[model samples]
Target: MRDYLFPTEIERLIAAAKKSPRHGVRNNLMILLAYRHGLRISELVDLRLSDIDLQSGRINCRRLKGSTHNIHPLEGDELRLIKRWLRVNSNPHSEFIFVSERGTPITRQSAWRIFKDAGEKAGLEVNVRPHMLKHSCGYYLADKGCDTRLIQEYLGHKNIQNTVRYTQTNAKRFEGLWR
Candidate 1:
């Protein structure tokens, strides 16, 4: 009944997305960025090329639902993937980073379908909805011992309460209680 994907599951999804017959690079980058940056479907689909600063290895995350917007540093892998996608992009003129075959910005529905299909292709046990990527990012950061406040800001949560749940279920927090 877990809603978030483990790191291994995320890796599997990325691999599965890469195997797609069309737009494989685009699809995988979508998943990777969504998970890495804790982006909601709307946010992911709304991303623009101008939001990323390749020279600085950073991205301006435009959060929704009144959350605070922040710049997130892109990992080397993410940067490489993004560069690869850009080189193979169907339409270089499109404002959005991710685009459909027609060079239109990818819709939220299309992004959802891409994640779901990648999940199925990865043989994931849980139904992979786009939001799960966001949740997975939160949990991953929590499990890694990242400060709750930092995780909150990273996920763009206006309230710390929203971020606590990720840490609440982390068994590692109680690992030494009996000792």
Candidate 2:
């Protein structure tokens, strides 16, 4: 099976969102967080305001497939962007972070639309799906010399086999081998 990875498209999506009247900071933040934290579509839509700790810059992402949870921290520009996004979009009493204009948590279809529209605007030829963000995160970490065990933990994958693909795809790991 092919892994739909797009670390670069993720950046392009953020850039394109800034130019869009509709995409706004919230949409950009959602896309960034999806890649940074390896979140599934359901996890992204299911986030609640209370699950975030602004002072600590931590997000308690719900690992949907395994019925577990993992804590991921925001760093650098992501932390700043999260603060800005919350300032504009958060309803203090709302049950979820990302919501429709009706103030309800966005459905899976809406999440799908968010990525698809942004990908198109970014000039990406591939059909964008939210899961690609997760794959990008995994591949990114692997390519950056992060351990497979850590990637598995960060992604909340219960099986190591699921995480092994990233190790296989990291070409840099083979660099300097003939030296």
- Candidate of highest TM-score: 1
Clash pairs for candidate 2: none
Give all candidates' CA lDDT scores.
Answer: 0.95, 0.82
lDDT of 1 by residue, 1-179 (tens): 88899999999999999999887899999999999999999999999999999999999999999999999999999999999999999999999999998999999998999999999999999999999999999999989988899999999999999999999988887778888
Candidate 1: residue pairs that collide: none
Query: In terms of TM-score, how similar is model 2 to the real structure?
Result: 0.91
Cα lDDT of model 1 overall?
0.95
Worst 10 residues of 2 by lDDT: 1-10
Error of 2 at 97 (Å): 0.7
| Candidate 2, superposed: residue stretches over 4 Å from native | 176-179
RMSD (Å) per prediction = 1.3, 2.0
> What TM-score goes with each of the models?
0.96, 0.91
